[model samples]
Target: MAITTDKMEGTVKKELHVFYVLDTSGSMSGAPIGALNDAMRSTVEELRKKDGEKADLRIAVLEYNSANRWVTQGNNGVENLQDFFWTDLQATGLTYLGGALKELNTSLSRNEKMKAETGNKVPVVIFMSDGYPNDDWQEGLQVLAENKWYRAAIKIAFALGDQADTEVLAKVVGVTKQGQIVPNYEAVIKTNDLQAFSNMIQVVSVSASLAASSSQMLGTEVGAETIVREAAGEGANTDENGVVIVDATSAGGDIYASDATADDLDGFDVI
Candidate 1:
């Protein structure tokens, strides 16, 4: 898909930037990568369906393995949802999460990708990873933490499967609205089921976008807590055909469980 660079100008609508930081490491080479691709395509499609008049929703996708790359590189690394396109990402190499974090920090700057424009809403950053970082992720996170936008942005993380390090994810998604530098473990949703992972991606993305876009008008804080609470609510009423969402805090392990006939192994392709 071609990456477009045009931005909507002279519009009264507020801009809601949604950043997706994805892990495409060697460990995600098979089924995990496939599920991620499917989920992202669906999520973007749903976001595009939203009323454009409400908010000028923008999306940025950053994928990291041994190196980090922007899938949506035009328009200061973010593009309007209506113009953005999804290209399937291949998984390989180590998980260089630290590098990705540093790159994200650069983009979040007002002098760079995130411009200081009127009607700019608080950005929403969603991170997904299935393994521990092989680089100095904490240092990169520290640099990001110093950014005003990073501190105020609505952050959420997904620990995909047992191999994922929830503790690390907790640190990345720090306390929302609170000035203290504390990890928000409640913001990390751990799931082993590929179907459920895919479903949760959409649920969280849609819910966060809706909440963040209108948060200022509602006089509420747009944070991971709001997103996680909405996701848990959706999970409680998930249909039989849908995957059951569980909270990692309550489940003590995985955040999703399914009794569907499909074999768990079949959900992820062996590379």
Candidate 2:
């Protein structure tokens, strides 16, 4: 087997604030939800490998159908998942992408304000979905895009299965250095199998890492035995609610691209 390794000659601390704006509509009932749950659980397991101590890692989950529910945090509050058992989500409602996005925008603003007031590091945001938005996400998207560096953070969009709209996701991902040259550069899992979601998470985490790290675009390759590193993006990234980080030395280190951003602020410095 070939090996992928980056000299750990230097160290980088990234703190992440990941908010899963997922679609828990009735459509996601059967395999999709099962798969999504598995994917999320496996992701946390991998995250646990990174760092599981105190508020050292914060996780936020946003479940949206015709509406949105901030699982970890309040309706607009950003709470740390370090306190709750994050495995209690039900499926019921319509698919209101716009409402979800609007609420999400509010939550982030709240998260940032709280962090600033308490002298905490800024966070990264990730959006995952399997369907298109029923609402006008454009305004929310614009709001997210022009929120200034301090708040407008690195964002990655993953559209799963055929239900997800690639064109829309593409627009949301925006134009990145790596993405511009070769669009769809980030990991996109369009599989029907749920177990594959774990693999998707592995790839996503890598992309998040690339976003948090140096502005080299994603260079990590995805493969079996992908190892999620702890404290990968400590200050600017989190293991619980953090940016995805994959090392070239690990299995799935090559999936991330440079188009992704860690956050709106100049949080983490690349080696």
Candidate 3:
């Protein structure tokens, strides 16, 4: 008789933390809110499908209305994407964007929301808002800008409606070390086109998931900006200053790229 032996090995996969910072203020009610809920549901389904094939995906959700609240609790608060339970959001109250940012800044540390896994890829933050902050958002934003995780992570932001704070959203994502800003979807999405908006969200989520799962693809580091821009397709348009613009067709009439020129904003950095 021959002796038989069994051996086991453990492999630790890198975790990819995805955070959704949503605005559920009263203005998002009706059609806008409905579309957002539907889109998020689809996003969850898409992530779950890619869960096993990709990085160890985890998700955390934050909502701001009258005040900031964690829809999904803790620093290690995220559940595996495959097992995530997304509670549909309802639109109500004020847009306390500052409060939400403050909480996120606090949670960005390794001791908080980032306290999971021995090694992980940079976190991905998807933020959306349809209006201006009703509170002192500048202070909170300052803290966020100072956060190492926030600066190093992949950041994506969407300006949902015409009244949405596009300028502020741009600032929140900031400029990459290479002087590139994180993918800002303000211009590409129409204010009221819920279908288009939803599609953009799903595309961005899936793209980020795939990119974060690996260290390199196509001879380039799969950073947040790279994945976002790739996922945006024709919907993505950025001018010389790196600010994404609305499609020419959506901007009243068609404007040819060859005929366009960069805006000379002496002291401004557009997102």
Candidate 4:
């Protein structure tokens, strides 16, 4: 008698999509926007070369000023987000974050960029702003919170200057509602310094892209919690001064840790 055992086949490579929601309002002009351009250019180059080894990486960018526009195009209102390329952005107009959020929700489906059956990793969304919304952003946020993909995506935000509303940014990046916490991965970085601003742009973009690739290689899904851990290692969780960045927490409360004690809590015992 002869017996044969079946051999498992290799998994098909899945798509990893990264969406960038950028505020190109007039306030972002001068050094802030300049740094953003440079950092984004570097990020594009880094991801192009680094992520191809493990996964098929794709990117889509939505910029909002007085209105929102897609920097990259797709066919028939659907973006075929594979082998992504980046286009440098300029700053102008008002912060219409709501419009951008609405567009993001529309684009994240099987009819658009997502393929739920393919084992595609959850998408990552990075939002950056230097001011508050000039439109009905709350409505948009409400709609976005209901989107399955938006809920699952790795969300991060940067409050680039002091004028940037940490409260609003907090709500957008890490929380779905006033008191609810985002599922796993969400972070908000705040800094008024341009150098630190640019550094974080590079750090977060590259780290997120690499995490997507690593997950593909390991045959594991990219976990938002995991992204947070890896990003901390790459110094994305702090300012140039080494202060750990504070993210939004449970809506209406302290925007940051009450004291520096939490910063030193790593060495303390909790039992």
Q: In candidate 1, residue 93 scores what lDDT?
A: 98
TM-score of every model?
0.79, 0.62, 0.77, 0.71
The residue-by-residue lDDT of candidate 1 on 122-198, one tens digit each, is 78899999999999998898888777888888888888888998778888888344434577776777787777777
RMSD score of candidate 2 (Å) = 14.2
The superposed Cα distance between candidate 1 and the true structure at residue 180, in angstroms, equals: 4.7
**Judged by TM-score, which candidate is best?**
1
**Every model: Cα RMSD to truth:** 10.0, 14.2, 9.5, 9.2
- Candidate 2 Cα deviation (angstroms), residue 112: 5.5
Weakest ten-residue segment in model 1 by summed lDDT: 236-245
lDDT of 3 by residue, 124-177 (tens): 888888899898887788767777887777777777867887777777777454
| Candidate 2 global lDDT | 0.52
Backbone clash numbers for all candidates listed: 1, 40, 2, 0
Q: Which ten residues in a row have the lowest lDDT in candidate 4?
A: 248-257
Error of 2 at 198 (Å): 2.1
- Please give the distance, in angstroms, between residue 80's alpha carbon in candidate 3 and its true position after superposition: 2.2
Per-residue lDDT tens digits of candidate 2, residues 105-195? Answer: 6655545423533333345455667787878877766655544431334455555666776556545545332333122323233334355
Sorted by TM-score, highest first, which candidate order results? 1, 3, 4, 2
TM-score: which is higher, 2 or 4?
A: 4
**Candidate achieving higher lDDT, 2 or 3:** 3
